[model samples]
Target: MSTPLIPLTLLLILTAVLVESQSIIPIRYDGFVYKKRAASTGTVLIEAFYDPVCPDSRDSWAPLKQAVDYYGTNVVSLIVHTFPLPYHDNAFVTSRALHIVNDLNVSATYHLLDAFFKHQEQFYNAQTLGMSREAVLDQVIGFASSTLGNSFKSAIKSGFNDSKTGTKTRVSFKYGCSRGVYGTPFFFVNGFLVPFNDDDTIDYNGWRKLIDPLITKKQHYPSNIF
Candidate 1:
């Protein structure tokens, strides 16, 4: 007898349920949270806090690169600095180099990152990469001048020296501290810090296990950004 009214009531209840779900289900990529670039819509964010002068960090570079390449658009690699040791004098310089390259709005930042790691042994020694202060600046100048230009080279050097004014370095450090990063090679998946030293070795398998799921579940659609 009241079938029409019952249908109407059910429709109203369903609408309310849908509205509540929309409000409660958190959207991940709204904006750049914590100064780290937001992941693309429906994608995962990987915030890596690494030190260029850290031996362990260097060892992780290969696997990290592979993961980034495999994930492609599904992952955003937000690299930050957690420079801990004082003996790694060139660490700050290297960080500034990446920061400057990033400023250029080109992919050269990734290139230099891999290049630096590839040649890490050549620069670093048994006593922390054996890099003298003068040589460190020179290496930066040589790399930037050859690939980018003299202006960029100078900017990199200036950025490294004036830590007081280097916004990028400050931002990186801030991101690290905010995430409770105490050392190099710390990896965060989707804003969550990964547990470390469980197996007494930070190997490629461990990183892949943490990251592969995020990559597989990510979805992408065409964007209007230009």
Candidate 2:
């Protein structure tokens, strides 16, 4: 005997329920996740893909920090991903050190980033500058040591060789690559890629323009949610 079919309405409802269950997207707190001062339900996530030695990335630092300071956690959250460019010989090593710093202390990671960008010239090797690779690596590690204390020196050294750190760094780089990030200082605001022109400045106004609309759009809850 053939089985009886369910009602059309019931079948549609079941399909809708299955789709909704599968569509639930989890919040990813990967990389150096920096939350705002006061997080709320409507906080927009900003994913930044940058390289420590990239000048454009360095230029983006102030504006990004300014946006967080202005909006706070109530409006936005920032996730920093290290996408060390292959051309920069010392960038990979620097990124590995940063990953360790991020794991040890999130706050100190910010300081280390600032230090790397501010004194980028000191860490450049022969590929970008006249310094040797050893000297550059030493400078980067020493900077981390100074910023995070000497006790962290051994951990940082071990992190450089640790396969886990390498895996994390590679994963971050691949994540950005999969999302069409070909250059440093690439940004995704709430999963919407922000179109950036090389000549255009990524200042507070630029960021505010992109972010304000998203925040405003998020304020309106779905009508279906009863």
Using lDDT as the measure, which candidate wins? 2
Which lDDT tens digits does candidate 1 get at residues 1-226? 0011235664564455455444442222211122333454445666666666666777776776565556545355544453433345666666767766666544566666667776666455453456677776787668766656566766666656665435555455544544555466777666677776622434667667876765555433344533
Candidate 2, poorest ten consecutive residues by summed lDDT: 21-30
Query: Which digits, one per residue and each the tens of the lDDT, describe model 2 over residues 99-155?
Result: 888877777888888888897765555544776667666777787898778998988
Question: Roughly what TM-score does model 2 have, to 2 decimal places?
Answer: 0.78
List the pairs of residues colliding in candidate 2.
none
Q: Give the TM-score of candidate 1.
A: 0.63
- State model 2's lDDT: 0.73
lDDT, model 1:
0.57
